[model samples]
Target: MAATIGDRENAQDSVRSRKTNVSESTMFTQLKTREPKAQENSSTRSFVLLALIFIGALVTLGIVYLNFPKLEEHEKQYIRLPRDIEDAKKLGNILSLYKEKYFYQVLGGVFITYIFLQSFAIPGSIFLSILSGFLFPFPLALFLVCLCSATGASFCYLLSYLVGRRLVQKYIPDRVADWQSHVNRHKEHLLNYLIFLRITPFLPNWFINIASPVIDVPLLPFFIGTFVGVAPPSFVAIQAGTTLHQLTSSGDAVSSTSIIILAILAVLSLLPVLFKKKLGAKFD
Candidate 1:
C-alpha cells in the first residue's frame, strides 16, 4: 500500500511540472511576437511621415509654379541656366522685357521658390539667387535674396531639428561625430564659426543645415549667421545680374576677386572668436 501511495504522489508531481512548463512557454511566445510587431509599427509611422512631407512639398511647389507668368513655348525655353553666362544673359534679356507687367508675380514666385528649395535642401537656390539680380535692382534684390535664404535655411534648420536629424545621426554616425566634435570644441565661439562656414564655400550649405541641429547649435546664431554670411555672395550674384549678359558661364559669379573678398570676410568673422579663445586661455 505504501509503495502504491509513493508512485501516485510521483505521478502528480510530474503532471504539475508539465503544466508549469507549458504556461511559461506560452508567455515566452507572446513576448517574442510582440517585439517584432512593435518594431513594425514604428517603421510604418516613419514611412507615413515621409510620405506626408513629400506630398506637402509637392503641393507647395505647385502653388509657387502657378505664380509664374503664363509663357509661350519658346519663351519657356528662354529660362536660362544662370551658371552658364550666355544662358543668364539670354534669360535676363527676356525677363527684363516683362518685368514691368509681371513684376509682382515674378517676385512672389521667386520668393516662394527660394524658400521651398532651401527648406527642402533642394539644389538650384544659387540659380534663383542669380535670377534675383536679373529681376530686381541691387538694393531690392539683395534684400529679397537675404530674406529668402535666411527664412528658408531657418525652416530647414527647424525641420532637421524635429525629424530629419535622427535619420542623419543613425545612418551617418561618423560624419555626425566629426561635426559634433567641431561644434563641441567651439561652443564659446560657435557664432563666429557658423559665420565663417556661411562666408566660405568650403562646407556644403546642405550639410551645414542638416548637421547644425545634431550638434546642438542654437537657432538664433544659425539664423543670424546664415543671414549675414550669405550677404557677400548675394551681393556678387545681384551685381552679376546687372551685367548678366556679359558673362559666359556661372563661374563668373564667384570670380577670383569675389573669392578673395569672401576669404577676407571669413577671416574677419573668426577674429572675435579667436580673440575670445586667446583671452580665455590666458585667464586659465
Candidate 2:
C-alpha cells in the first residue's frame, strides 16, 4: 500500500510539471503573435503624426498669404517708406486712435497676427515692426515687438526642426545642395552664425529664422541669441517712430547715425567668437 501511495505522488508531480511548461509555452506564443501588431501600430502612429504636421504647415501658409498686405505697384517701386513720411504720420495717427478706441482687443489681435507673420517667414515683418512703433509708445511698442518677434522665431525654429529641411530639399533642391556643405561645416557653431545673420542687414531676418531650424540649431540657444540679437535693431526702429513728425522724407526716419550704431553693434557681437577662436589657436 505504501509503494502504491508513492507511485501516485510521483505521477501527480509529473503532471504538474507538464502543466507549467504548457502555460509558459502558451504565453510565449501569445507574445510572438502580438509583436507584428505592435510594430504596425507604431508605424501607423508615425504616419498620423507626419500627416498632421503637413496639414498644419499648409494652414499656416494659407493664413499668412490671406492676411498679407496687397502690394501696389507704387509701393513696390519705392525703396523708401511705401508712402511719403507725412502720409506715414497720418496713418500712424489713425492707428493710434484706433488702438485707443479698441484698447487691448485690437492690440492683442495685432500682436497675434504679427507673431504669425513672423513665424511663417512672411515678407512684411519689417513694416509690421515699424507700424508697432508708430501705433504704440516706445516701451509698450518695444515689448510687443520683441515678444512677437521671439514667438514667431520660435515657431519658425520648430517648423524647420520638423519639416523645413525636407521641404527645402524637395522644393529648392539646388539651393539646399549648394548650402549643405557650408551648413554642415558650421553645424556645431550654428548659434553664433545665427547671431551674425540676425545682426547683419544683408539677409532678411525672416529667411534666417526659417532656415535656422533646418540646419539643426537647438531651440534654447536659438531663442536666447535671437532675443538679444534683435533688440538693438528693434530699439532703433522704435526710436525712429518717435520722431515721425520731424521727418521731411522717408530717409529721415532712419539716419546715417542709427545705421552706423547698428552696424557697430553687429560687428561687436562677433567679438566673442573671434576671441574664442584666438584662444583656441593659442591653446592648440
Candidate 3:
C-alpha cells in the first residue's frame, strides 16, 4: 500500500510539470504574436507626430516669408532657403541689397530661419551663419548666431523631453545608455562639459541636441553653455562671412588657425572642472 501511494505522488508531480510547461508555451506564443502588432502601432504613432510637426513648421515658414518685405521678381528667386554655399551667396547678395532699407524685416527673417533650422536639426545653419556675417556687423552677427543656436537647441531639447523618450529608448538604447554614463560622470560640471562639446566636434551638434535632454542635462546650462560655447566657432563662421564673396564652400569657414583656436577654447572650458576635482581630492 505504501509503494502504491509513492507511485501516485510521482505521477501527480509529472502531470503538474507538464501543465506548467504548456502554460508557459501558450504565453510565449501570445507574446510572439503581439510583438509585431505592438511595433507597428509604435511606428504609426511616430509617423503621425513627425507629420504634424513638419506641417506646422512649414506653415510657420510660409507666414514668415509672406511677411517679408517685397522684392523684385528677379530677386525673389534668390530669396528661398539656402542649401549650399552658392545658394547662400545669392541670398546674401539679395539681403545685403535690401537689408539697409528694411533692416528689422531682414533681421527677423534670418533670426527665425536660423532657429528653425537648429530646432529641427536641419543641415543649413552653417550657411546661414555665414550669411549672417555677410549681412550684419561682426558683433551683431556673433550675438544673433549664438542666440539662435541656443534657442533652437533648447527647442530640440524640449521636444525630445516630451516625445522622444520612447523613440530614443527603442532605437538607440545602447547609444543613449553610453552617453548617459558620460553625462553621469560629469553631472557636477555639466555646463563646462557642454561648453567643451560645443567647442569640439567629439559629437555632432544634431546628436548632442537630441541626446542632451535624454541624458538629463538642465535647460539653463544647456542654453548658457551653447550660447557661450558656440561663440568661438561662430566667430570663425562670421569672420568668414565678411569675405563671403571669396568663399567657394562652407569648408572655407574652418581653417587650421580656427581649428587651433577652437581646440584651445575647448581645453580652457574644462579647466574649472579639473580644478574643482583637484581641490576635492586634496581636501579629502
Worst 10 residues of 1 by lDDT: 79-88
Model 3, residue pairs in steric clash: none
Deviation from native of the Cα of residue 42 in model 1, angstroms: 3.9
- Runs off by more than 4 Å, candidate 1: 1-44, 77-91, 281-284
Residue 222, model 1: Cα distance from true site in angstroms: 1.1
Rate residue 264 of model 2 by lDDT.
Answer: 89
Error of 3 at 132 (Å): 0.8
lDDT, candidate 1, at 177: 92
Local distance difference test, each candidate: 0.80, 0.68, 0.91
Off by over 4 Å in 3: 1-28
lDDT per residue for candidate 3 within 1-284, as digits (tens), equals 99999999999999999999999999999999999999878767876887688689889988989998888999999988899999999999998897888999899999999998998898999999999999999999999999999999998888777767677777888888988999998989999999999999888888888888887788899999999999999999999999999999999999999999999989999999999999999999
Clashes of each: 3, 0, 0
What's the CA RMSD for each of the models? 4.2, 11.0, 2.7
Q: Estimated TM-score per prediction?
A: 0.80, 0.62, 0.88
